[model samples]
Target: MLAELIRRDVDDIVDEWEQFARSSIPAAEDLSPEDLRDHARLLLLAVAADLETVQGEAEQHEKSRGELPDNSPQITATAHEHAQHRFEQRFTLDQMLSEVRALRASVLRRWVEQNDRYDPDAVAELIRYGEAMDQALTESVAFFGAKVDQSRGLLLGVLGHDIRTPLGAVRMSAQLLERTKGLDERQSKAVQRILSSSDSMRSMVDELLDFTQTSLGMRLPISRVPSDLGSVCAEVLAELEALHPERDISLACEGDLSGQWDAGRVGQMLSNLVSNAIQHGNELPVTVTARAGAGDVSIAVHNKGRPVRPQSLATLFEPLAQAKDMGGDRHSGSSGLGLGLYIARQIAVAHGGSLEVVSSEQDGTTFTARLRR
Candidate 1:
């Protein structure tokens, strides 16, 4: 049913395009080859727009349904059919039009190319018309694409907000349960586990909500005041130690490491990086280092682990990329929505800084966050 509605929408757009093309380019009996070619290019643009709208609508409908549509396989088949139709119908028209335009351009350019007896006024008029048509088509395509992106972002933001509300309430209730009295040791352990699980779910929900907001160009509200990078590192290290008392973690400071940044964001970034390193890195000691300079400050969290693969390196900052299998370790129990590095990078960018990764088999991996002066 939704597919039919989308298909109808595509048809409507196509009809609108046809009307636009007919009005823009009249079908005169004595039309020049260049005019015909321009009409054909406009037609092609309309067809491309129709295809994009159809595809986008189908994808969105699928998402809304929370499952693939019943007609999805049929739709895929129809898309192949449409591709073949393009070659048969639209491609031929485009090629014929292109050839006509090229021939006309070549004939007219001969006068200018030879610098001979031909008048220049007519050639200038042809060039001007061609440039105008090109600009109009380019602008139209860009405008439509931007509209589609904005629509998608708004939908995702709404969905993220709805999902987070319930998750937040569940987390609060779980914490309340943990504080109840008269529980035996075994029951206490179970309650603690529930609290931990709730915390993890809440974190995942927050990350998704943040990503949605960022997708819509929303910036994090971070206040920049004098903050100690060393202090931030120490706080994050302390939290991690409390969480994982079995792990040997150390914090090292090379200088006073004072800087200007949002204290909360800085702390969040460090906590994410350090937690990731400890979870994925080898059992050897993990180190958090801070260095201050005249114009900038740098913080790095290093861990001993297997080198990250080259292909996965580019996508490291993308959410959900490592939440499932960190370096192929299934036992890690890190089933997150994959927003840690993504959020860290966003915060760094917001602070006019950057985050980077360096890894080697022998030395392990180091993730650094640098804030400029």
Candidate 2:
């Protein structure tokens, strides 16, 4: 049978597999032979054993769908282990997959050479072997992708933290320069630019840190104290007005705006919404409204401009979703890594609230955050 043949020639197949993997992948160049051959023998034996299992028509269908019982634990465990080791070795995902591909080719070539007679059993065995390889590849790829995401989150966390110290120093220096006496007009303008640029960089760093926290499956931390929604909206609007002097931004508040909430996070959410409106609102006036419902508080930022595309509405708040400048008077300084809305939504969610948007050509676009008190 094919299983016995695999068991007998596994070593020979692995030798060819190792050679091909080493030659094809640059990262494998520095790895020792033992590392290169890691888990190969076990993977091959697991596949051979899986081929020998008695799978009925139903099980075969489930296997094809990747929903069948894991007949061999070794395949799954070895795939994860191998992928983890390769990731630590600095091998790229493609490079690691190339090794798997080489092993598949080596084994298939040897099997084909031995089985010149094309019969039904031979065809079925070949199909099963391909399925096994595919299963292993899927496991390894998933594990590798998870590792990559974790590393990226860690790097972003470190970068965001490390950059803040220098950014703070620059901002402090600019503030000191602004207070200096007898400054010329050009010098004053330059200092203002420095402070503005520093604020922008600080905003981006905060967004990156928030993105890292959310992507790592952690909710945004909030400290709820006795805070007024009206005060929060006013403070955020004042800051935004200073940053965007040319934009006409107004705030309207009514009905008990006092609540127990994180005022700072709410301000952050409002700032993101207002900035997005100003950038995409086609140089139009933006309005902020806060209303107190029976048990909830709703804050909406409205702007008149081109409506967001219907398709994009679903993913508008997803991190890194391309905020395409869709032929409008988008602010020149509005470019970002597309994490503003995502972080805003996360903040709202953390406060046991939700953020939503409604856009239409005639009615304009409005983003609303409803927080439960």
Candidate 3:
């Protein structure tokens, strides 16, 4: 009975929905009837299937909010396809919402007109219809938002990569200016400032690139070769100390430090963790320790400072989860985008390794990366 009703009313529901779609979404104005009605038939059929399903009130409550993740992939997949098409067709969230609202109202209007008078069970059917609609709408919204985020991430990745060529040229010109003849002391300081600012810009660009690549379902690229992990950490530390000589950073390497891993990526991760330590730690010396045992290598960056709150430990590795004011260490190269630890963790994941952290008042905080050698 439910399926028959949907089969009877699907065209009307779609026509009414398309009118709302066209008015609300400029892109939908150009969509053909096939495109505008994309998946509407399947969506209505899925709702009809749900109405026929024998589900308890408890299950209904859970499913209404799209909480029954294991119930029906067919239904969810249909909704996801609908959302993907809408996203590709450039329908905004608002327009999509409007279309769904119009669909429900149209279906209700048809149901009312069909019986000529309201059935006593109309309220019960209405509740089940709303639940099914909610599930489909939730699935659609989730898919739509994911597609939108991926597009944004891809755009940022391309933008960040393109910005680097010009930035490198600027850095090269700044270096040449530093070596210019007949430069006064004031002129030299100005050149130094320009160099510093350019380096900061370069770091920001690199972070943005890393963030976007990871967000867009791509890993940061790395080239693996025989490299000494100890030397890599030392080289990274030397560069960091030059930028932050006032702070104390020491490296301790033990056992075999040579490995077949991406030296540049390792250095990048080490640099990020150490920089994070310096920024969040107190005026104490930050320590980086690398050790190789058997077929495993571990690197730990340690600092004695305030402990990361327990609540924050869960989300600390998430991109941009840290506060801006908590960062901004002059040499940290973090414009408070909070991507350092996130990028570092991703580098470890790409290397088939893992990044872990332990923080406490007594022991301070430590970020450790374990890699298989």
The model with the greatest lDDT is: 2
What does candidate 2 score on TM?
0.96
Task: Look at candidate 3 and tell me the lDDT of residue 120.
Answer: 53
Please list the residue runs of candidate 1 whose C-alpha ends up more than 4 Å from where it truly belongs after superposition. 1-149, 319-337
Model 1, residue pairs in steric clash = 282-304, 319-338, 320-338
Which order, best to worst by TM-score? 2, 3, 1
- Candidate 2: segments with Cα more than 4 A from true spot: 69-71, 325-335
Q: Please write out the lDDT profile of model 2 over residues 1-373, one tens digit for every residue.
A: 7788889998888888888877788888888988888588888898998999887888777888899647557788889999999999999999888888888888887887888698998888888988888889999999999999999999999999999999999999999999999999999999999988887788888889999999999999999999999999998999889878998999999899888899999999999899889888888999999999998899999999899989888889989874574446545344456888999999999989999999998999999999987
Q: How accurate is candidate 3 locally (lDDT)?
A: 0.83
In model 2, how large is the Cα lDDT of residue 181? 100
Looking at model 2, report the run of 10 residues with the lowest lDDT sum.
326-335
Q: Estimate each model's TM-score.
A: 0.59, 0.96, 0.85
> How does model 1 fare in lDDT?
0.61
Error of 2 at 117 (Å): 2.5
| Residue-pair clashes, model 3 | 0
Would you list the C-alpha lDDT of every candidate in the order shown?
Answer: 0.61, 0.88, 0.83
How well is each residue in 23-92 modelled by candidate 1, as lDDT tens digits?
A: 5433322334343334334333432333333335555445334344332332333333333333333333
